[model samples]
Every structure is written in structure tokens, then in C-alpha cells.
Target chain A: MNPTKPTDDARKGDVVSPTKDKGWFYTDTVKDHFFHPRNFMQDESAYGEAAMGMVGSPACGDAMKIWIKVDPATGRISDMKWKTFGCGSAIASTSMMSVMVTENGGMTLEDARKLRPQNIMERLGGLPARKVHCSVLGDKALRAAINDWYRRAGQHDNIEIEQGRVIDATLKITDKDIEEAVLDGADTLEKVQAKTKVGTGDPSCIPEVENLIRFYKEKYFGAE
Target chain B: MRDIYLDNAATTALEPRVLDAMLPYFTERPANPSSFHSMGLRAKEAVAAARGTVAGILNSREDEVLFTSGGTESDNLAVVGIPRAYVAKGRHVITSAIEHPAVLEPLLHLQKKSEIELTVLPVDRFGMVDPAAVVAALRPETVFVSIMYANNEIGTIQPIAEIGKEILKWRKEHATPLPYFHSDACQASGACPLDVEKLHVDAMSVNGSKIYGPKGVGILYLRRGVALDPLVRGGGQERGIRAGTENVPGIVGLATALSLARQEMEKENARLIALRDRLIAGLLAIPKTRLNGHPTVRLPNNVNISFLDIEGEAAVLYLDAEGIYVSTGSACASTSLDPSHVILATGLSYEGAHGSLRFTLGKHTTADDIERVIAVMPGVVQKLRVMSPVNLDMKYFA
Candidate 1:
């Protein structure tokens, strides 16, 4: 069976109908494309496509990606689309956003920030209370993409400054070099020495070296 | 259409025969079993006879059976009762990672009162707990080892007999000192074989509702001489382990239901196993479909599958629209926003767990029902997948 064809009884429909209020509190709409989702995919290497990748807490049940083609000359979005992998509400919400963005002549980056869950759900006719978060995912994805655009544009200097301490401390040495050294059969001390360029004499790199060694041991050998 | 009823795990439709057996207790003979009159004595005899039926099913002594309100009460009495009785022997207890909250929560509560150390062993992807892990977790202070006979959600049966033998070996090695063992056999009562002596569990919990009986009734078979504290301090009805007014009607129904289920066990298991396999085969044939539990060792009627690009709740709704009902996870914890702990513990992403559905079978489930779901699921999943905003490559699901 194709599993898509509605059975005759289902299509014939006058099955015991619920009271009007009991009718579907919400109706599903194929407002956004699912497989070849409307405006999905990104030209990852496109010269100026504003791209955002969002990873939802697996605890919450979905994640999304949003991409926008912006014409820097006019500050107006040239194309906007989203890809959300989640519940019906989530898919519908993201789809609704894709439709809204394209239908209304893509929002100027600033206008996109004001999008709300209700606006998207209302646009989609209405999502059940339980599915309201689906709409929020779409809104959040758009905002995140915009933020990513601004960040890449170097417009959020304060954020970059505030995050400086973490950046400097973690990236003081490239983590990849440390990982590679361990994988190449280097001993803990040797790997740390090679990556940090600090001899075993330096007490500061001791903890970092120990942690890196421990991380590798646990990851590769199951030895904590 | 009738309201969709997917909460069969919490309880079940009362079998007509079981219901008939209890009508006299409610109306014609409303006599307290404790009463000295003939009517009361008759009720007492019913309880005794029911005990025999329940005991016969488990292959245990009739006196070893203690009827309670249901699985929750039985679990509390077993997990909390036996441990408290032997608190002086040791304070450590062993259980599994995927226990029903009834077992997990009570064990946690017991930890508060005494210096009881708790070790929760983990389960593998198939939801099967390693018996060797249980043996390893047993310590000199280990008072009891509790593992559920079968996982309620994923339907994975544990190597319980092996665990029991290992515990016995430890007891002999330590010279008459070893941890007692308990298993919440609620899910396995009707679906699988449960020979207490062969399994070597000191105690086990069984619920009537899960086996097509009336709710609010169940039993905990405490191997004679196992000490335990009473969770409910009241009329001292259940050998002082559980204190409550006896639910005579419910007990009669539970006993009858158990007998009926036991008689039909083999046939029912084969029937549902065929149906469940068909459902799994159908779902797996669809693109992006993944089976969430073990293939051969799972519950005969449980088929939990995840559609990668579609949300589980939406799939459930679509199925329900066409008169099929199912669940997202454990019915007890469904109201919570988070995905199932068991699924998460199996290392699935929240999206993966959320996009999962559990289709459980019962005596009434038919091939047609499975076909109905199989027919609608792929299309529904496809529709939702297309709408999903996740930029999954089309080929991934197509």
C-alpha cells in the first residue's frame, strides 16, 4: 500500500463527526514545501548568503537551519528560506515563515527580528497550543540567521569583545594540533609539549595537558 | 468517532468474563471478607481461590501471593518493604536505568530515610540490562537487586534468570549472606513466561489492568521469609506490607483475568508477535524509518519506530485522524515536554526520540489495524518530512 491514499471510508467522511467545537481545533496545511521545501538549501559558498545553523537541545525535539541571500547594496533580503527538522508544528511554522518571507518581498533584516510565534501560527490558520513552539522555532531560526549575518558583518563588536576571554583562553593553542599529536601515538607529556610549545617545566600547561590526555584516553581507549 | 485510547499500558479494557466474576462482590454480596458471616466467609474464599489462580500462573505457593491495589503499590511494597525489613543486613540496593518510575521513584525516596546506597545499572540500546553488570554491582553492603522483567516502553526482556543464578552464587560464596532480588514483572505477566523459581527472583510485581483485567488491583509475590517494611500504615490488610480496605471486586477481577490470560498466553503471544512483526516490517519499509528496540527479544506487540524527517506527535495525530491511536513514549510521563529518558539514555537525539511512536497490541488488535496504520504512515511521514524545516537532503528520505 502506498500509505498515502485515504481509504474510501476516510474520504467519504461522514463518519461520526464530533460537535463543531470538537472538530479539528487546528487543520494541517501544506503551507511550506517539505521534501523540496520552498526556499530550502543554501549555496554554502555563495558570496554573500547569510547562513545560520541552530542546534536545538535534543531534549526539545527539533533543530533548524536558515539562510538568506541579502543584497548588501539595498540592505533588503533577496531570498529567504529555512529547513527545520522536527514535529508537524515545527515544519509548518518554518514552512509558514518561508512562505511569509517570499510572499511579502523578503523582510529587511531588522523587520525579521520582530517575528513572533503567534504571527506565524495565525498566518498558518492556527497551531494547537501544544504545537505553538513549532512556530517559535521558525521565528527563532530567522532571528538567529539575522544575528549570524550581523555577526559576520562585524556589526556586533560588543559580543565579540565580551566573548574575547573564552576565545583567547581556548584558542591560545589550536585544539586540532593537540588532538592530532595524541592520535599520532604521542605520549601525553610529549603531545602537550608539542602542541603548547611549552616544555614539561611549565606548570600552567600541566592541567591543560593532563585534561587533553584524559580526553583522548577516554575517547579512544575508554580509559578515564 | 470515539476518543482515541492509546493509554492501554496504564490500564486496559476490562474483559467481560472478568467483569462478570466481580458483579456479585459489588451488588449481590457486599460482605467484608473479615466478617464472620457466611457471606463474608464466601468473599474470603474468593480471595483464597484467587490467590491459588495467581499463584498457579506464577508457579509459586499460593500463600506467597499478596494482593495489592496495582503495580505501583506492589512495586512500593516490594522495593521499599523488603529493603526496610533487612535494613540491618545492608543498605545498598541495585536496580536498572530504565525502571518504571514506580520502582525508580520509590527507590529514590528510600534513599532519603536511611543511608541506603543505590546503584542503577544501565541498559543497552535494546533496553536489555546486562546481568553481568548486576553481578558486578552487588557489594557486601548490597541489600537487594531489582530489575524489571521486561521494559514497558521498548519491550526488551532482561536476562533475569542468569542474574538470579549469579546472585545465588554470591550468596553461597559469602556464606549465607547475599542481596535479595526483585523484579517488576508487570509487563511480562501475560506476554511472557514467568516462572518465579526458575527466574530466582525473591519478589515480583504483577498488575491486573495490563492483562485485560479491572484496574486498581494487582499482586506482589514475596517469596516467603523475605522481610519488608509496610509502605501504607493502615488496617494491615496485606500481611502488614500494604494497609488498605480490601478491594474485593477488583481482586476477583484481577484473579479471573490472570487465569484467562495465562490460559491463552501461548496463542496470544504468537498472534500478537505476528501482528507486531508485520507492523515493524511495514514501517521499516518506509523511508527514514528506524526501529527503536531489539528485533527478536522485544515484546510481542510493541513496535516503536521513528520517522527521521517527521515529528512523532504529528504522525500520531495523523494516524488518530484515521481512527488509529498510539503513544509517543511511556504513558505515565507523556505529559512532560521532554522526550523519554529511556530513549535519551539509548543515545538518541531528542529529535529522534520525539519523532518516535509506540504501537502496542492487545487481545483485540488485528491485522487490519496494523494494515490501517501501515497504509497511512508513509504518506503522513512524507508530508511532514517535506514540511519540516530541517535541511535534510531529499535523497535522505526519498
Candidate 2:
């Protein structure tokens, strides 16, 4: 049971209210999954014959990997588990995703592949807006895992690679290029341009290029 | 459930003695010091005495101490006002990267407006600013230098007196008093030495809340003949440096708290150092754990450590569940989605900064509390680490 907290003065992280015991910024369902994550994979080596999906990075704030075993006889998920190096929101999101994909004799692989971050948010009573971007990278992680499952399951036709948003329409530089540039130690717009030639042809997309650099830096390097 | 408070660096609860001294001024003799009545005279007298108390601790004149709303305003006044008042001399300013945002943000805003050319000096791995580096950054146009007496995140004490001596010698060589030296001593007020003359700082900012006094009250000590443009423009109060109706109660509480702190400084510092070391040693015993700030040069009550593989927000929340309160430098814990600037400035990897936790001892902290933390923290870290996907090398950046 949760300790009753006064909701009158709840700021984004106002856990220490004036008149009550400490309260969490997250909902009770979110805290439950964070503290007691369902089907958490403590050691991956023991899980045996599962496809894994990973996103973000362990070096940064939010990163996670999910593993699932498909029941070949029924065409449903037999086991679902995850490991994460993220905040309360990210862990809860992934935990809820694992639960949703496998509960009640498991959902079919086609159904699990269609799951989105919004569905996870709705199930956990909606995540904080600030967390929606970083924490829900779990949705990307899950999609990667399902794609891996398709390859591992010999359903090669079902594997779908992500085509990230295009920032430079002229050079056809996608946002993934920007992320790779940041991971390769390119922090500034000029450095990213030097590496990827992003926005070289379409100078008008400079602003968008700058925004993507900042986003990738925060997502991959935790830079302000 | 066990309850313990360890986040003293963020803010402290008011001392009962401080609250006792402030009670009468609030409900009993409530009158503006500006009014020409007997009650007003008493209020004025109280404010003057509080000024004297703050000045006495800093070894400065009562006239030099200007009271304000709190540390932020005091910092704003010193960081912004000092350069502006001396702008005719030059338009250059210097500060350290590890300085509190109260000092850093204002200087940044000034630079953004092209009001001044700013140079942000870097710090060492232990978050110590180099005095020589500071001196090297100074130019003929340098109008001001601001650095904190102690850092809020890591509790690292800057070599302010050494830097002060360098600055004084530089001024002598250059034959110019263009660069005014300022220090934000809010976190340093009660724990460290704040004698302005010994430190050779032209100005210093001290806060009430950080010293176990009432919040919303602070003082800016401007050395004699040091001119600063006023920040708050109203009523020409505080010698025109800061203006507004004085917070008589908060001010009185601040003075009392500082005096109490001064009286007990030696004994309290000794007690806290013993407990702090015990906490640090216990935490470092964990595999892949590292301390954040300087080993011995930090505040007596501060203990900051990074637990690898697990994020700081998760640690803080899990500790909170066990009724042990603390704070962290992780981006996950921040609304801005960035880790602590102080931690980053110390050259910590993103993983290290995200995993950093700060536990500050205070008047209420005890040996049992430290023991409880040592006991609870290991299990918490193990739980989080087992669930985490990370296998950090401790040196990897991304």
C-alpha cells in the first residue's frame, strides 16, 4: 500500500510536501513497476534462445534491452523479460511492456510488434511529459527486439529496419546520421556537418540540423 | 519506518533558537523599519544589530553588510552589479565552470547580451579551481572575477585565499583595480571560514537557509570603497545596493543562526568530519564506486559518491522508500534532462554523473543515520545493478 500524499502542491518532482510524508513524482502503478519490475531479466545468459532489442545507451541516462522467447507451437510470446539503466519512468515503461506482451498466455508476435509508447503510457496511467521522449525510447528498443525475433525465427520477410526522420531533404541525411555523429564525438553543428555533410545542400535546414545535434547529444551523451 | 535527512546542502531546516529569536519581530512588534515610530525605531535597531552580527563573523564593517531576499539575489547583485558598476574601467569578467548557477547563470546572461566578454575557467578532476589558471585568464579589460567559496554539489572548497593573493598581486603589477573579486559563500557560511580580509575578496554572498536559519534572507558583504550598482531599485535601502522592506524576522534569525554556528563551528566540524569519513569509506567499499569531490578539502558534512551501473534517481527513490532521504546529480532526476553541471565540470563521464548521489550531514545527522545508510545502500545498489543492463568500464563516455 502507498502512503497517502497530499496532491495539492505537487510539482514535477515535489516529493517532499510540507504537511505529509514523502510522495513520488510518479503514479502508484509506475512506482510499483519501478520498485518491483515484473519479469526482470537479472542474467541474460540463463534466459536461453531469445531475441533482444536495445536502445539509447548505457553511458547516458536512459538505456534498456528487452528479451522475449516465442512459443512456436502457439505463435505467442512464451517469456518476456528486460534489463534497463534508466530512470523510474523508463524502467516502468519497459516492465509494463514486458508484462503486456506476455501476460495471459502471451500476446501474438504480430500484436506485440504493433505496440507503441502511447499504449505503454496509457497502461501506466500516462507518463510525465518530460519523460515521454527519453523514457519511451523503450518502444524503439522493443521494436528492435521484435525485428531481431523475426530474423531469429526465420521470418526474414517480417524484419523491418527503422528509417529515422529526415533532417536534410537535399543530402538525404536522416536523424540517425546525426545520432551516429554525436556518438562519434561530434557535438557541435559544425562538427556534425564536417562529418555528415548535413544541410550542405539545403542551408535552410540548418536550424533543424542544429536541433538534431542537440537532441542526439542529450540522448547519447547527456549533454546540456 | 526509519526517517533520516541527509540533503543539507540543498537547504536546511531552521534551528529552534533561530526561530525563537525571530518570533517576537514577526507577530509582536511588526512595523516597517522605515517608519519614524518607536516600534519602527526598534525594528531599525534590530536590523542594524543583525547587520553587525553578520559583519562580525566575516570580520568586515557593519556598513558593508547589505541584507537581501536570499542567496540568489545576493549572488545576482554581486555577479551582475560589480561588473556593471566598474564597467567604465573595462568590460571583461572571469568565473569558474564549477561555480553555482546563481553565480554562473548571471554571468552567462551578461555575456549573452554582449554587455561583457566572459571567460569560464575549468577545474581539476576533484573540482578544485586552479589559482594560477584564474590569474592566467585575467586580462587588462577584466573587470570582475567570481568563484564560490564552496561548491553546492560536491562540497569542494575553492582555493579562494590563494587566488585572492594572486589577484591582489596582479592588481599591483597591472596598476589597475579593474577586476573586483567576489565569492558566493552560501554553502560555506556555517561549515568553513568566511573571514573576508583573510580571503582578500572584495565581496561575498551568504544565505540564511543554508545556515539553519529562515529562508528568504541573506547578506552581501561589500568591502569598504568597493562600488557596486544596485540590483533592486526601491526606497534606496541597504545603502542603495539592495532595496525593499527589510525581512526583519528572517534577518534576525539569520544573524542568530550564524552566531550559533560560529560558536559551535569547531566542535560541530570535528563531529561531522568523523561521521562523514565513515560514510565515505563504507560507500567506497562497494565495487566500482567512486567519490565525486576532493577527498579532504571538501566540507566536513558532505559525502558525494557515484555507484556505477545504476542511475542516481533510482537510488534516491529506493532510499526514499526505506525512509532515508538524499539527492542525486542524474539527468533522470532533473526536469531539464541534464546531469549536474558541477559533476560534468569535474570531467566525470556521463555514466558517472548519472550515478552520482549526494548525502550531506547536518545538525540532525547521527552515527546511527550514517550506519543505516551504509547498511541500506549496498542492498539498494545490488538490486538496481542486477536489474540494469550496463557493464560500464568506468572510463567510457558513450
Instruction: List each candidate's DockQ score.
Output: 0.20, 0.34
Question: Which portions of model 1 show Cα errors greater than 4 Å?
Answer: A1-60, A67-81, A92-111, A118-135, A147-224, B1-10, B112-114, B330-338, B347-351, B391-398
> Model 2, DockQ value?
0.34
RMSD of each: 12.9, 7.2
Best by DockQ: 2
lDDT tens readout by residue for model 2, B1-398:
65899999889998999999999998998999999999999999999999888888999999999998999999999999989988888999999998888898899999999888999999999999999999999999998999899998899999999999999999999998758899999999998888999999999999878779999988899988889888779898898778899999999999999999999999999999999999999999998898999999999989999888888988898999999999987676655455788988889877677888999999899899999999999999999998888888956432
Lowest lDDT sum, 10 consecutive residues, model 2 chain A, at A1-10
Instruction: Give the number of colliding residue pairs in candidate 1.
Output: 12
lDDT of 1 by residue, A1-224 (tens): 11122123222212134564445434545323322246655444563446573534323455676886666676667777665666555665676677776665667766666565556656665554334434444665576677677777777841212111211132233344345445534456644443223222224555666677678667756874
Output the worst ten-in-a-row residue range by lDDT, candidate 2 chain B: B329-338
Q: After superposition, how far is residue B3 of candidate 1 from its true place, in Å?
A: 10
